[model samples]
Target: MTDQPQGAPVRLTAFVHGQVQGVGFRWWTRARALELGLRGSATNLPGGRVQVVAEGPRAACEALLALLRGPGTPGSVTLVVEQFGAARGEAGFVER
Candidate 1:
């Protein structure tokens, strides 16, 4: 479930903070993105932030952002910093 018949695709780069690391945040993002049929990657960044790059339909990406803002997981998410734009040729989702 990494892709679907969707509208004009887009991309979203997000920085999620607040107990993001060591709490399956990246894996959680991957699962959610797969469910949305999105393509991207979720990585751990410095300062305890999880960096996620998602590419898919605009609505799907936005939906992913919403969950990133408050997705239920092992840790509490307090913030999800993100920027949206046109897709940049990203493929399958990854965790790094």
Candidate 2:
């Protein structure tokens, strides 16, 4: 857990643009989300983008965001669009 007190759990939606669809971006996102103890799904959109929806403790979700946007990101992921909000209380993380 992070040092700061994150008031409540949250859900994070990220649209990773660029060459993100065919390069295992969804699976990578799922694995990382599950590893972080978050629950959500990663799906490939019609465009060359991957959408990651993660729900968990605020800090964990934030960590997921950092991972996708930082070094943990796949080589194909050039840009990441992130949105945060209240959690939907999902159960497990998966790839779709």
Best by TM-score: 1
Which candidate has the top score in lDDT?
A: 1
**lDDT string, candidate 1, 1-96, tens digits:** 225345768788988879979988889899999999999899888889888999988888988988887546648888777887778899899999
Tens digits of lDDT, candidate 2, 1-96: 333346777888889888877677788888888889999898878877788999888878888888887865665668888888777778888788
The TM-score that candidate 1 achieves is: 0.88
Clashes per candidate (backbone, < 3 Å): 0, 0
lDDT of 1 at 74: 49
